[model samples]
Target: MRPAVFFDRDGVLNEDDGYAFEPSKIRWIKGAPEAVRAVNQSGYLAFVVTNQSGIARGFYGEHQVHALHEWMAAQLADVGARIDEFAYCPHHPEGTVTEYRQTCSCRKPQPGMINELSKRHSVDIHRSIMIGDKQSDLEAASAAGVTGHMFRGPDLKEFVAPLLKQLPRIR
Candidate 1:
């Protein structure tokens, strides 16, 4: 099984522009692309797991989120980096959209997304790591049996480079 790196999209990969669902609003965090490339070279699968409560809140639709992600992927491709897959939860308990108003397991601090991804990708949870800028992110990672790192930085590559060195390399 391959170990993976789970990234919290908003605060970790890009600036959280409050319900940002447009490519124009995306401002990637410093070294975000390089950090991802490092993971790619380290033989770790890179995945994005995020919560998009804005969908439930009616601020945007799933199409917008998907389009934004596609745009983001193309941006990363420009730097020779690629995210294997993207997973996001649109459910919110208190929401304007009736279809997505109920609480679901896929949300952050819930571990549902991580658990599902681990199962589907055949991930070695023990060696997997999660990096996020929130307590909830760590909580979710713990629940899923993966190590979690808190990031407070202006440069992602600086924070990630050393951490990548410690993980067991996969063929």
Candidate 2:
């Protein structure tokens, strides 16, 4: 099994403009692509895990979320980075859309997404790490048995460098 780096989509990969689904509203956070590239170059699988309550609230559809992710992946690819997978939760208990209103396990603060990724990718949870700007992100990481790094910084690469450096070199 190999180690992986899980990143939160909003606030970490892009500026969180409330319910940002439009392509025009997407703004990549400083050094976000470079950070993912570094992880790729280091041979670590990179993934994005996010909670898209907007889908449940009727702000956007699942297709729009996928389109945004595709755009993000293309942007990363342009910079020689790649995200192995994307896990998103479009469910919320209080959601306006009846179909999306049920509570689900894939949401953050739960390990559903991470666990599923681990199973699919054969990732070593103990060796993996998650980076995000929220406490819920850390809680999810902990529940998944992975180290969680809180990012509150000037740039994504700068904030992630030291943590990446601490990881033992994988053969």
Candidate 3:
């Protein structure tokens, strides 16, 4: 099993513009793509775990989120970076949409998505890390038995560089 770097989608990878779903509105955070590429280069699989509450709020559909992720992947590919997988929760307890209104374990602050990813990808929980701009991201990482790093400001690559060095190299 390989170690993985779990990332939160909204504020970590792109500028969070209040439930942004449009491709035109997608703005990469400073060195976000490079940070992902660095993880790839370091022999760790990269995965995104996001809470897409807009889908449940009726601001957008799930298809829109998929489209946006697809666009993001294409953009990252242009920079020689790639995301191995994406896990998102489209459910919310107070959602306006009937089908989406439910308390789900996949939401942030919960470890459902990370746990699922670990099962699917054979990820080493202790060796993995999660990076995000919110406390929920750290909470989820802790729940999933992985180390979490909170990213507040500065370049994403610069923030992640030192931590990457601490990981044992895969042989």
Candidate 4:
């Protein structure tokens, strides 16, 4: 089975300012594109899992989230890197938007998103890894039976190369 690499959107991939939904607000982290390309070159499926509480907090809508992701995808594509898919949770318990005001398993610290992606892509979860900046991200990866890396990064490509070396080579 193919293994996957999951990334947390906010701190790991881009600079986050709380409710950042605007494409203009995004600031790509150093070597973000190269890190993605490294994963792509490693023959691993790359995916994004994010928590967009901004949607529930009434700061933005799903359309804005989609737009931002599309923008992110275009940026990655320009560098010959691409995300296989994206999964985000729009729910928050004290959300201002009633439609999204409920606890959900897809949120970080839960394995729902990773599990779903693994199932859909036929991933070998045991060999996969999750790169994130928060404990919640690591927790979700653990629950999903994948290893997790905490990225306190100034350069993501440098941080990712050694980790990529650990994956079992694809047949």
Candidate 5:
């Protein structure tokens, strides 16, 4: 089983440009690519887990979100950091869009996505890590039985290096 660096896309990978659904508006957080590459080099898979309630709110569609994610993946590939998987929750309990309005476990703070990924990828939940800029990220990791890191402030790249060096050396 492989360990993974589960990331939250909006604040950790890119600036939260409020319901960012377009590639043209994507803004990579400084050092985000390098941080992802670090995870790759450490032999850990990199995955993205996000919540896009905007779709449920009728601001966009699932296809649009996927397109932006595809562009994000392309950008990461350019930096030699490939995402092993990407998961998102498009449901909102009170969503404006009828089709997307529903309770879902895949949303952050529920661990649904992580649990599914754990089964599919055979991931070492304890050794795995989750990085995000929100409390839900931390809660999800905890619920999934993995360590979590909260990215604070503007530049997170500066912090990744030191943290990477300190990750309990895996045998």
Candidate 6:
């Protein structure tokens, strides 16, 4: 099974602006590409898991989200980094949009996203890690049985290098 490096889209990969959707609005954080590339070079699948409550609030549609992802991918590719997959939870328990206002397992703190990926991709949960700026991300990682890294600044390398060293070498 392959090890994975799961990142939270809003804060870890790009600048967090509440519920982001527009490609033009996306901003890459410092060390973002380098961190992603490191994971790739380490033979880890870099996946993005995001909580987009804006969709639930009727701020954007799925098409917009997909477009944003395509744009993000292009941007990452430019830096010699690529995201393997992107997963998101668009539902909001108290969403104003009726269709989106439902409690779902895919939401963070539930581990549904990681669980789905683990099953479908044959990922080793113990060898994976989740990086994000929110506590929810850590909670989800813990629930999924993966190491969690909380990101508070722009430099991800500083946060990740030591942790990466601690993990058993893959090669």
lDDT of the structure predicted as candidate 1: 0.94
User: Against the unseen true structure, what C-alpha lDDT does each candidate score?
Assistant: 0.94, 0.92, 0.94, 0.93, 0.87, 0.87
TM-score of each: 0.98, 0.98, 0.98, 0.98, 0.95, 0.95
Ten-residue stretch with the least lDDT total in model 1: 16-25
The digit string of per-residue lDDT tens for model 5 on 1-171 reads 888889999989999879999888888888898888888888888899999999999999999988888888888889898889889999999999998899989988889988898889999897888888999999999999988999984666686777777766555
lDDT of 1 by residue, 61-144 (tens): 999989999999999999999998899999999989999999888998999999999999999999999999999899999999
Worst 10 residues of 4 by lDDT: 11-20
At residue 120, what lDDT does model 1 achieve? 95
**Candidate 2 lDDT over residue span 29-147, tens digit each:** 89999999999988899999999999999999999999988888888999999999988999999999999998788988998999999999999888899998999999999999999
Worst 10 residues of 5 by lDDT: 162-171
Candidate 5 is scored at a TM of: 0.95
Q: Report the error of model 3 at residue 67, Å.
A: 0.5
Candidate 6 per-residue C-alpha lDDT over 37-81 given as tens digits, one digit per residue, 9 for 90 to 100 = 888877888899898889899999878999998988888899898
**Model 3 agreement with the true structure over 84-111: per-residue lDDT tens digits:** 9988999999999999999989998999
Clash tally, candidates in order: 0, 0, 0, 0, 0, 0
Between candidates 1 and 6, name the one with more favorable lDDT. 1
Weakest lDDT window of 10 consecutive positions for candidate 6? 162-171
Q: Between 2 and 4, whose lDDT is larger?
A: 4
Q: Which ten residues in a row have the lowest lDDT in candidate 2?
A: 152-161
Stretches of candidate 3 above 4 Å error?
A: none
